[model samples]
Target: MSNDNDIRHGRHCVFLMHVHLVFVTKYRREVFTKEILDDLRPMLASVCRDFEAELVEFDGEDDHVHLLVNYPPKVSVSNLVNSLKGVSSRMIRKKNYPSIRKKLWGGALWSPSYFAGSCGGAPIAVIRQYIEQQQTPH
Candidate 1:
């Protein structure tokens, strides 16, 4: 079990951080099947581990995937995203070249851009309540 603080005792400092990542398929094509999604989870988890980060959660539909990752401050989010995308792209291509090639057409598995956001801050309940109480135009 981990704490909200995610405080890691490194030689120089302690830090805790998380990020939500989204990767879309090239041309927004629907290429992922149930078997592919299943294969992707572990592949992504392995990538995260290689980066010294943790894959908190991984799920998505046919054209994209959402990954919740806990990473240290030393790692840049963009770099992580690039590595994740690059490695997975190659691996998936090698494994499922025929199907992926047919769908993507450009030999690219993922689009150039991705979405990444920091996670783990204020409690979810508190944030939900704050949102729920917001006054909106009727």
Candidate 2:
């Protein structure tokens, strides 16, 4: 079945593709506290929306963040990463996450890098299912 809302530009446009992206704090900085995560949550969501991606799932263990995103083929991984890192860094810095500021030192909180892989096929469906089950019951 086709998902019309997912279409971009026009009917002849390509179907949206999905990817799972993982970004880490520089040198694994332990900055993903509950408070910090809360602070960044909405910002990340808005940015992802602007990029035509959904931040379907996200979590971190102080050092790294794992995000499940569904993006169009037109959205490059580098562009998405740049926007997230850039916006988060800017906002977090403005919010005065001292540890992040001290550690990153005008640099980005997320390393200037990321891990991205496709999420599709039957296995991909299984992974998304698992992720759904793992949701924290609101």
Candidate 3:
């Protein structure tokens, strides 16, 4: 394996873990402005750092955000998502309440549910082909 594919070493184990996360706004509201999305990236990075993870990529549409994250074996995905959503929601709302409140009238920024998927470093084309080839049992 090349250096790029080498596993990460923790105190007693070696592993590679990555996740793709999507967070949507409450009621699927289109509440995020360009400024809010820009501000959110750093906040997410900071949250990832707090969990000893790295935020690999961040982008989103007006109502949802997509994140690619690299995390260790010790971290729980659910817990990380909770923290990320909670902290970012609080901070963004605190700083941009006027804009946010207009769309998210309940004062909550994110919906309770979010989308998360594990990534195994496979090429997207390969994954798409594999999925497309799956068939139902007779």
Among these predictions, the greatest TM-score belongs to: 3
RMSD of 2: 10.4
lDDT of each: 0.85, 0.76, 0.88
**Candidate achieving higher lDDT, 1 or 2:** 1
Q: Candidate 3, residue 128: CA error in Å?
A: 17
Question: Higher-lDDT candidate among 2 and 3?
Answer: 3
Per-residue alpha-carbon lDDT of model 2 for 13-102, expressed as tens digits?
Answer: 766566777888888878778888877778888898998777777777788877777777778888998898899888888888766777
Q: Encode model 1's per-residue lDDT on 59-130: one tens digit a residue.
A: 999899999998877888999999899888888888965567787775689999999987787778999999
State in Å the error of residue 17, model 3: 0.6
Error of 3 at 78 (Å): 0.4
Query: What TM-scores do the predictions have?
Result: 0.81, 0.74, 0.82
Model number with the top lDDT: 3
Q: Which ten contiguous residues of candidate 1 have the minimum total lDDT?
A: 1-10
Candidate 1 residue 117 Cα shift, in angstroms, is 0.7
Candidate 1 vs candidate 2: the TM-score winner is 1
Candidate 3 TM-score, C-alpha based: 0.82
Candidate number with the higher TM-score (2 or 3): 3
